[model samples]
Target: MSPLIELRGVTKSYGDHTVLRGIDLEVAAHEVISLIGASGCGKSTLLRCVNGLETIDGGEIAVDGDVVSGPGVDLVRLRRQVGMVFQSYNLFPHMTVLQNAVLAPVKTGLCSKEEAEERAMAMLGRVGLADRAGSYPDQMSGGQQQRAAIARTMLMSPRILLLDEITSALDPELVIEVLNIVQDLAESGMTMLLTTHEMGFAREISGRVCFLHGGGILEQGPPAQIFDDPAEQRTRDFLRKVSLAGRL
Candidate 1:
């Protein structure tokens, strides 16, 4: 079967600063891939490009064999197939958790309000936030809010999920709850591309770990190999720094 997502010579730039340069990657069905690198290494930009949140300067990105990077693409359709959750929870402060979760599906006419609410409730339950459904964002902890954000995205039933540092904004104590939800999603066969600072979690949950450097994937392999025995010098150096910082 063809890959669920593919990037061929994908490139992205902001004026003279290129974030992603000729990035080629393929994500198979049900595979979990994690991108790990220092800041400014293009991990987030690559995820943005995949979901059409950022336009590429060169090459192509395809989801299920349809090009989504170029002009005339149906962005609405593309986004529906690829759900993204960013570092910020992005929930409406005034809306209850249930309302926040169901807003997109209802507004997009993907389902009736009743159906959206039902699905939203079910997703909230899956994320362990069923009781918080009636609570507002400010009433919940950072972890709860992020899980609600995940639930909101999952309600779309996208073919793939893009997570760009979804736990970055949370307190250290709250990070594990969000990671556990992601781990559960992985176990349930969700195809995902994530950029995370949590090395141990990435090592445990990702089937393949990619080390991005200087606007490209410097190295990629099974987590054991990539983390324990990287073939590239840059990969080793990056891991050493992470380890020294008590992050690995």
Candidate 2:
């Protein structure tokens, strides 16, 4: 089978400020790849490009062998197969967890309310939030809200899930709850592209890790090699500082 997603020479810029430079990467089906880098290294931009939220200035992006950014691709349809979770849980404050999770499937998949509700309830259980299904965002903790967001994404039955630092905005204690939900998803075969600073989680849960620096992937490999014996000096320095600080 072809790659679930591919980025070929993908470059992006906001006028003179180049955000991404000639990125080439591939994500296989059911694979989890974590993109780790400094704050402005374009990891989120790259994820946005994959889901068609950000258009590329040059190069091509394809999902499951169909070109998304180049000629003859249906962006709208492509996005339906890709779901994105944000750093700030973007739940509708007015909607309950079940409503939030079922809305997209009911609207886009044209499923009956009963079917959507069933799927949403199952997903809530998957994220360990079954009992809180009737709660609104305001009533939930940051971690619960984020997990609800993940369940909302899963309700779409996406082929790929793009996570843009989903735990960055959470409290330290809440971070593990959200990460645990992600770990469950990975274990159960969800294809995920994540931008995160949680190195321990990335190392433990990811199939591969890509280190971005100065707008592109400076180094990438399996967690053990990339975390223990990175080849690039930039990667080594960044890891050292992050590791040291993590100890504090």
Candidate 3:
């Protein structure tokens, strides 16, 4: 079977500072992958590129056998199939949680307002935000807001999920609740590609772990091999620093 997501020789840059350089990867259906590395290593950019938020400079990216890179691609369509959750909860401040969750489906004509609300409520309930449906973004804690953002993304029934350091902005105490939700998604066989600093959670939940370094994926393998016995020197050094910092 074709990979659910495919990137070949992908490259991206902002002026001269390239973020991703010839990044190639393949993810299968229901596979969970974690991209781990220091900041500015293109983890977030890679996800953005895949979801059509950032255009690539070179190479090709395909989702489910259809090309998604370069010009003329239907970004809205691409994003619907490949959902993304970012570090910041970008909810509409004026909208209540239920309103925010239903925006995409209703705006895109995917469903009527009533249908969207029902679907959004179910997703909000799944993310443990049932009680917050009537609350605005400012009324919720950081964790709760993030959960609402996740529920908003999931309401579209995306085929693949891209998570970009979803826990970095939250207080440490609130991190567990968000990670628990992601763990539940992983266990439910959601296809995911996530950039994360939560090493332990990534190791515990990812089917495969990829170490991104110097604008490319330096090494990737099963979690045990990548974490315990990685093949690349850079991967070893990176893990050592993470270990020393008590992040691994």
RMSD of each: 0.8, 1.5, 1.0
- C-alpha lDDT of residue 138 in model 2: 98
lDDT of 1 by residue, 1-248 (tens): 99999999998899899899899999999999999999999999999999998999999999999888888999888989999999998999999999999898988989999999999988998999998999999999999989999999999899899999987898888988988999999999999999998898799789999999999999999999999999999999999999998778
- Rank candidates by TM-score, best first: 1, 3, 2
Model 3's TM-score against the true structure: 0.97
The lDDT of each candidate is 0.93, 0.89, 0.93
Q: Write the per-residue lDDT of candidate 3 for residues 8-100, one digit (tens) a residue.
A: 999999998989999999999999999999989999999999998889999999999999998899988998899999999899999999999
Superior by lDDT: candidate 2 or candidate 3: 3
Best by TM-score: 1
TM-score of each: 0.98, 0.96, 0.97
Candidates 1 and 3, the one with greater TM-score:
1
- Order of candidates by lDDT, top first? 1, 3, 2
lDDT of 1: 0.93
| lDDT digits (tens) for residues 35-91 of candidate 2 | 998889999999988888888999899888888895566766776799899999899
Quote the lDDT for 110 in model 2: 51
Those runs of model 1 whose alpha carbons end farther than 4 Å from true positions after fitting are none
- Once model 2 is optimally superposed onto the true structure by TM-score, how far is the C-alpha of residue 209 displaced, in angstroms? 0.6
Best by lDDT: 1
- Off-target runs (Cα >4 Å) in candidate 3 are none
